[model samples]
Target: MQHEHWWPRPYRFDALLAPGVARARDCAGGIIVVKQGGVPAPLLRLRHPHLAAVVAADCHHHVLAWAGGVPMARLAGRVPVAAAVRWTGQLLAALACLHDAGVVHRDVTAANAMVVGTDAVLIDYGLAAPPGSCAVAGTPASTAPEGWRGHADARSDLFAVGVLLYRLLTGRHPFPGPPFAALQRILHGPVAAPSTQAPQCGSAFDPLLARALAARPSDRFASAAAMAAALDAAQAAFKLHCAANGGLARVAGECRKNGNRNDKYRERERKYRV
Candidate 1:
């Protein structure tokens, strides 16, 4: 007699996407990922354009609809300000939707964010929970100060966004060191302005980052939508300042043109399902 299996039927394992995660192809040849963990209760029905879709779930493992792309971790410290602004906006929108559903991602790190063509998709809901859930879970470097205290909320995710944006802009973590050292710095050390390391960022991002990375959650943007709007305004101001100084304006313009071309290319790729 054939033995029983752990994962559900109608799905065959194709390849290992990572440790504890495997890519599984459905009967119709659609790609999905089976992750070795329980789906957080709060996110069982959560869905958003920028978030990876959950297809099925059980206590032992959960499957997510797959999107082909590169992880943001691989592109860390190399993303241009123009691209960073766009991608960050996408992430914020995802967070806003999650927050509206009364869920907090808890862990929003570079590895969890993917760049699919010209769009950004937030993936991996393994650490997601409702706001005010007391648990310390997430990548050490990206965890907020409040996270260290066993408290997590929407604003805590915003702190991680600040760290991610800082890395994209400056090409380095705001607090760099071993995991423990980084935690100490996050809890007590001061973060430098992004422009100090990346002159291209200019002063426009200084205040915005300060507010996002603030040690106190109350001092940060009230919500993800608010932070997204601030990022848009800051990018516009930075472009204007660059134009006045005759510095990065040309580069920004070139990036925008290239972005448009990329969007068209992505649309074609989607049409062909490439």
Candidate 2:
């Protein structure tokens, strides 16, 4: 996430970028706009000396730019499901790229998954631990079960991704609690499907969200790619149901306008079909 901010004292650009810290150069400002890096050296730095691919630079990239998109939570109201689903792909692709580069993103929430010109870039490595490292930084609710003790791993990142996925769909965190409370719930409470919290979402999507939030890392989708594939399938089903029902609903409304007595039956069918 590039921002209009200045570097702090003791942290210089040359020193920052030397370790291959991820940065964004602002052409307009004629300077590097944002940089995310940490500790000069450790037994192994989880996020520092970070390796990341620049998926997108501008704010217009990714699903957030889709037509009729919902405002980001921090921005305003809920965004359309279509836009959210579209952006889900970008997040998956970004994760794949990082893993391929031999890096594990410790943070993978909606906040870090910023949309840049219709592209989503994984940002904020403050708590990122190197692959297989025993260091972790990220919100407790988004952190994996093993992360409570500062264990960062590929699966842990996936867990955070799952939390993000759940939030995108329901507009609420599955585990809602203060830092300590949320962490305790995540460490002890059973995973709840989004449908369970928001029954309006229907049963079709609950399992996928549940699988993503599974307590056992192995039980969750083996990788972000797998989760994406599963979400793609669920989204297909959701769209199909909507398309079929939407057309019927419109016809029923038309029948009502014409004062057709039988329109009541059609309305029922439309409701169930949709």
Candidate 3:
């Protein structure tokens, strides 16, 4: 008897189930494979128009295999500052695209976000409903505290992006505690700044994060584009500052070289030109 596997393949398999690896399952869906024991290998058997069943050797890509590569949580910890900025910025951009398409990704968290190489891709569509299907799946920390429920709007997606960015910066969830209790607090209380948890960030990022996590959706940035623009500007400002500092150092070096050359030339002229 053949073992049963559960894998769902939709329009396009543009996702990297794992890092540095790509799996292709043709038109028909693919099989969700698993090993019986010992390190747990996978038998991802998918139906191909040409090849009847393409079996992958020593590959694990079951429904659960979505998390095949690195644990996103750990990646968050190991990522350097620049990479985190890029990852969060990309997430915000993806959210903007979804909003432009009139699709609301109610569930947006770090776990649903896959870190492929240096880029971040948003995943998990279980809660992805159309404009108004009335399925609320977003975590509380990613939602407005009051008078905002029912299927979620573009603003909802923005809120989630804010939460994601907060986590990347602080290495902690903005809404922490038991799921139920934490959700309740997020609904009522303002999300504390990442600086609160990561004082190393100082107060520079506090306002930026707070504005994104505002309780009143209206109070928050108008759209994902706007939020992304703000973040981009902040990153640009930092880069510009660094460039200016580097330029200053270069100029100082040139001045020192010229000063030393002038001193030597003057001494030589005094001794020989006279």
Candidate 4:
């Protein structure tokens, strides 16, 4: 096999028959499984609540313990604004941890985030690189404008988070169309505010997304922690508005609808909670 050399002693290839295996394969980082071994030394060193755990690894590949949950992609348009805000905060926290470790997650798309219980976890580190790597990698729809010009850093990752938040709020990409067209829109076209696409999201998201998806790195949040703090404030304000206007019922209704649509995920969530 082409990957026969990827696994070293004591860690043999397992029969890749888990749900997480499929998801890992589908992810950009492409983490896989290797049977019966401790997590590799290098992979085990970095630890964070929101980062997926690695099971084993070698120079060419990493075997991550399956992070079982629904992909954020599946929750599009169904997530309540409060839930979306919370999840985005969790992802930003994850990014902060990665950034602090001197690593930049070049790929930060909806498909790369998994919702486990009430929390969000960031998976797949295949494209991760040190700061200022300028690799020109990541999914086009979520890539920052500077990314197309072969630059990627913490701010570039934040841009992708903005894209994910837009999808979660409005159930669509900000720059929707064919790949090239979307890339062009990201580069030069204007993005409508999330409230414009889905009024329920409110206007607070407008300025936040504007800053997050800014054309220039210097114009975006200074750090992931800073962005997360802003999101927390937005979430708090949203809660107050809902409580005063009786919007809590609407939020609950949306959660119920989403639960009905994803019964399996609810079951998985129950298992995790147990």
Output the number of the TM-score-best candidate: 1
Tell me the tens digit of each residue's lDDT in model 2 across 63-119: 111112222333111333444566666667667656655567776777666654444
TM-score of 1: 0.85
Clashes in each model (backbone N, CA, C under 3 Å)? 0, 13, 1, 0
Tens-digit lDDT string for candidate 1 (1-274): 0111245688888788688899888899888878765666545577888898767776666778875888877666554566778889999999998899888888899888898887789888777777877878888888888887788899999999999888776668899988888888898878888877766557889988999999889999999999999998999888876877676645444434533223343333343221
lDDT of each: 0.78, 0.54, 0.54, 0.72
* Worst ten in a row by lDDT for model 1: 265-274
* Model 3 vs. true fold: TM: 0.61
Position 221, candidate 3: lDDT? 85
- Find the 10 residues in a row with the least total lDDT in model 2: 60-69
- For 156-255, candidate 4 gives per-residue lDDT tens digits of 9999999999888777799999988887788886888877777555576888888888888899998999998888777777677667657766644544
Candidate 4, poorest ten consecutive residues by summed lDDT: 34-43
- TM per prediction: 0.85, 0.65, 0.61, 0.79
Q: Is candidate 3 or candidate 4 better by lDDT?
A: 4
The TM-score, computed over Cα atoms with residue i paired to residue i, of candidate 4 is 0.79
Off by over 4 Å in 2: 1-31, 39-77, 247-274
What CA RMSD would candidate 1 show? 6.1
- For candidate 3, the per-residue lDDT at 142 reads 61
